[model samples]
Target: MFQKILIANRGEIALRVLRACKELGIQTVVVHSTADADAMHVRLADESVCIGPPPSRDSYLNIHQIVAACEITGADAVHPGYGFLSENAKFADILAAHNITFIGPSGDHIRIMGDKIEAKRTAKRLGIPVVPGSDGAVTDEKEAKRIAGEIGYPVIIKASAGGGGRGMKVALTEEDLEIALQTARSEAGAAFGDDAVYIEKYLQKPRHIEVQVFGDGFGRGVHFGERDCSLQRRHQKVWEEANSPALNAEERSRIGGICARAIADLGYSGAGTIEFLYENGEFYFIEMNTRLQVEHPVTEAITGIDLVHEQIRVASGGGLSVKQEDIKFNGHAIECRINAEDPRTFTPSPGTITHFHTPGGLGIRVDSGVYSGYKIPPYYDSLIGKLIVHGRNRVECMMRLRRALDEFVVDGIKTTLPLFRDLVGNADIANGDYDIHWLEKYLAKEE
Candidate 1:
């Protein structure tokens, strides 16, 4: 086991990794930007170092400063808690060259899965199902049009290196394909410095189902289950639930086994998610996240597995402790990504939190990094915390989620709490009758 681990991020995820390290009796070093001098993770870390000023590029995203922090603190391993450098293959390679461990998959695996185009090819080669689409990057307008024609109309153009809904456009007909391709390429070049884009047969009502997978880097792996992150806005997941309400035991088992086998075949270590778009009776691969997801708590809540601890163990050369058959899924879990934003307008809300309260009960868990007087800086992501609830079944889980939401409170800044309150009571959300596009349509109606 590592004696000390450096956390290379901030906010709730940083705090989450810190707590996990503490539980395993490992000392922790937390790096923070000047804007996060008083951040919760820094305050609670065994040791803290100020990396640089905020605006992430100079601070949280600076690789050299992070390496210096690790060297200064004698941190043998780094747990990048999502975002920033988590998926940077070069960062992982650099750490390894310095004799420091990155508590996730290898740089090779990260490189293969980070690019959407390559990931699709790898997924297909691994026997995973994928949507019918172009074999590789559609470079020219002619190639884009040809793929769209073959796939039928209503194709989607996506950046080969894109995420967060950027560099993506949908064309309902052949006439719209040109504009969609041009816009997607332009956005791709601007956002990712890569003008490569691909085409896929767009599914109208697919549910965003992602399987949670873990590996030991020794050709061994296991899958917990699936999470339904269908409730999204602008391609961002707002709410997520484990054991997707849309899938049954047979479907879940089938996809989960496929993902577990794929990860094992790749010799992947630590936590990763194989995301898919599920519609009717088929599951089509969308992409793969090479690090722990923002919505991991829901999966932890259902499986009773401490993923962070497992990540640390596997990265430290310890093989997987639980076998696939030994792992059991117990209950339904839901996670609400509580962000500092206007519920109605979806604008960023950055300010001091004057009053703060969190709900606590048998099935409710809140992971937050803010206090009453904490200042939410605008330089970083708007997320403040996550509220996860678990219950014996879906019905019980929703009821518990509703009760917990009523008790969550934050003041002196706008938040999306009200939005969750409404979602919990809506007939569609209540019955799990929602897709990736459902929230966008619902929000449009309200506007």
Candidate 2:
């Protein structure tokens, strides 16, 4: 086991990793920007280092400063808690060269799965079903048109290296294809420094489902089941639930087994998620997240597995602690991303939190990084916390979630709490009759 681990991120995830390290008798070193001087993670860590100013490029994303901090603190391993450089292949390679372990997959695996085009091809080779699209990236508008026509109308153009719905466009007709292709290419180039784009036949009302898989470097892996992240806005997940109400035992087992076998075949280590779009009882591979996901708590709640502990153990050459058949899934869990944003307008809300009180009870958990007086800085993501709850079933879980939401209190800033409150009372949300486009349409109806 590593004596000390450096956390290369901030907010709730940083604190999450710190707690895991403490439980395993591992010291934690937290690196933070100037804006996060009063951050909760820094306060709890065994050691803290100020890397740079508020800007992410100069601070959280600065590789040299983070590596230097690791060297100074004698941290033998780095746990990048999502975002920033968590999925960067170059960052992983640099840590390897320095003889420091990155608590995730190898640089090669990250590189292969980071690119959407290559990832789809790899999934296809592994016999994982993917959405019908061009065989590879389409360089010109003519090729894009040809591919779109072949795939049929209502196709979507996506960036080869895109995420968060930034570099995507949909064309409902041939006349819209030219503009969609040009816009997607331009956005992709600007965001990822790659002008490459791919085409896919867009499926209407598809549910966003993802399977969580863990692997030991020695070719052992297990699946913890699936999470339904269909409730999204602008491609960002707003709410997530484990053991999706959409799938039965047979479907869940089959998909979970496929994911685990795929991970083991790839010789992947640590934690990763394989995302798929479900429409009409069919699952189509969308993409793979090469690092821990923000919605991982729901999975943990149902499985009772300390994913961070497993990650560290895998990096330290310890094989998987649990086998495939030994794993058991219990109950239903839900996670609501508590963000500092206007519920109605979805605008960022950054200010001092005057009053704060988290809800607590049986099966209710709040993973937060803010306090009563912590000022939410505009320089980062709006997410301030996650409210998770578990119960015997979906109905019980929804009731607990509603009760917990009513108890959660935050003042001096706008939050999406109102939206959740409304959602809990809605017939569609309560009945699990929602999809990727449901939230947007719901919000539109509200307007």
Candidate 3:
């Protein structure tokens, strides 16, 4: 076991890792930007270091500074919680060269899975189900058109190196494919510094469900089951729930076994998510998240497992403690990401939180890093905390979430609490019939 670990993240996730480390008897050092000197994670961590100023590239994304902080703090391992450099293969390699463990998948796996096209090839080789798509990046308009023709019309063009819906465009019919390809390539180049784009058959009104998988270094793995993250806005997940009401018994057996086999085939290690877009009873592989997801707490609520501790133990050369047969999915869990943003315009509202409160009860859990006096910084991500609720079933879960979202509050700045209040109370959400586009159209109708 590592005596100390450095948390290379900010906001609530940083605090989440810190608390987990404390419970596992591992001291944690937090790396923060100059703007986050007074951040809550810094205060709660055993040690804190200022990496750089406000900009992410010079600070949180600065690989050398994070490495230096670990060296100075005697942190033998670094946990890249969710974002920033968490999925960067080079960052993992850098840590490895320094003899410091990265508490996730190995660098080789990261490199292979980081690229969408390459990951598809890997999945293709392993007999894992993948959506029909281009061979790889389409370098010429002719290649793009040829692939589009073969895949049929209305294909989705995506950046090979992108996530979070940054560089994506849908081309309906052949006439639109050329413009969509050029635009998507430009966006990808500008956003990710890679002009490479891939094409895939797009699923209409798909439910984004992902299987939570954990693997030890020895090719043994198990899945904790799936979470429906279809409650999303602009390709970013706002709410997530486990034991998706849409999945049946046979579907559960199929997806769970497939996810486990996929992880084992990749020789993956630590905690990673196998994301799939399900529509009309067909589940197609979308992508994989190479680190702990922000929605992990919901999985924990259902499975009653400490994923953070599991990640630590696995990184320390420990084999998986649980097997596929031993894992059982139970109950239902829901998570609402309480962000510091406007509910109407979806803009950042960075300021002091004057009055802050989170809900608590038998099945409610709040993961947060801010207090009433804490200032929400403009330079970082808007996520403030995650409000999670667990129940015996989906009906009970929705009711619990309704009450929890009502009780949760924040003042002195705009918040999505109002948006959530309306969402939780909606009949469609309560009835479990909402799709990916349902919220956007519903909110548009209100406007």
Candidate 2, residues 281-354, lDDT tens digits: the string is 88999899989999999999999998888899999998888998888898999999999999999999999999
In model 2, pairs of residues that clash are: none
**C-alpha lDDT (0 to 100) for residue 218 of candidate 2:** 78
Backbone N/Cα/C clashes per model: 0, 0, 0
Give the winner by lDDT: 1 or 3: 1
Per-residue alpha-carbon lDDT of candidate 3 for residues 188-241, written as tens digits (9 for 90 to 100): 999999989999997778888899998897878789899889988888899888
Q: Report lDDT (Cα) of residue 285, candidate 2.
A: 96
Scored against the true structure, residue 201 in model 3 reaches a CA lDDT of 92
- In order of TM-score, best first, we have 1, 2, 3
Q: What does candidate 1's lDDT look like per residue over 1-447, in tens digits?
A: 999999999999999999999999999999999999999999999999999998888998899999999999999999999999999999999999999999999999999999999999999999899999999999888888888889898999999999999999999998899999999999999999998999999999999999999999889989999999999999999999998999999999999999999999988899999999999999999999999999999989988999999999999998887999989999899999999999999899999999999999999999999999999999999999999999999999999999999999999999999999999999999899999999999999999
Each prediction's whole-model lDDT (CA): 0.95, 0.94, 0.89
Model 1 clash pairs are none
